[model samples]
Target: MASVARSLRKVFVGGLPWTVGTNELRQYFSEFGHVVNAFVIFDRNTGLSRGYGFVTFGNPAGFNSALNQQKHILEGNVLQIQPAN
Candidate 1:
């Protein structure tokens, strides 16, 4: 049997509004491509957004499309999108 290798298709989203939740993040990014998963990091103590999050795409094409945008506006905040290391 052979194992399949998948290309990296995850992006790091920063400068997110504290009010933005996982659902909102997913919804916004869905416009660019098929969002496999999206999540906003939260502070464990306050349960508030950590101002950063991650979005995963089903394929690299979607990831590239999103990366080309470089920046996005959501909830009146400018979001920084970058490829996840």
Candidate 2:
């Protein structure tokens, strides 16, 4: 239980372009804070982006900064951000 509670906070990002990848996702969110881990879900069969991703912040400040922000635009698309369930 303590391990789960200490897990890095993740933020869900939607509306990402299919062109976006892990590197781009990490780069974009780095502005908010240190990104512990960031990944864009990809279709194994097609090798294409699924248009969404997850970002884990190294600390709470980074997590909250990303979550509190009203808008996040990446790759010419307005990204939807929220806490991951």
Candidate 3:
């Protein structure tokens, strides 16, 4: 099984308003880590957020900084930051 720290990089964001896009989410988390990649979950047909997403960082230490500082959020919604699996 993968550890929590690895998972933390791939956070599960929630409660994102309909207006927000994957780019916006990425920009938000980038402050914490060197955002390597970010993908906001979306419906296959509609391409909309299922109110969650994943943010991966280049370095694990950056991920830890984001976690410890509690710097995850988007438009006032506190993110559900956690491991990917």
Highest lDDT: which candidate?
Answer: 2
Which residue pairs in candidate 2 collide? none
**How close to the true structure is residue 82 of candidate 1, measured as C-alpha lDDT?**
85
Q: Count the backbone clashes (under 3 Å) in each candidate.
A: 0, 0, 2
For all predicted structures, in order, the TM-scores are 0.89, 0.91, 0.76
lDDT of 1 by residue, 1-70 (tens): 1112123788899999999999999999999889988999999999999999999888777888999985
- Which residue pairs show backbone clashes in model 1? none
Measured with C-alpha atoms, the lDDT of residue 52 in candidate 1 is 99
Per-residue lDDT tens digits for candidate 2, residues 1-85, read 7445435478889999988999999999999999988999998999998999999888899999998888888878999988887
Error of 2 at 48 (Å): 0.7
> What is the clash count of model 2?
0
Give the candidate number with the greatest TM-score: 2
Residue-wise lDDT of candidate 3 within 1-85, one digit each (tens)?
4545455566566677767788998888788879888877788998776887777888887677766775555687767666666
Runs of candidate 1 with Cα error greater than 4 angstroms are: 1-7
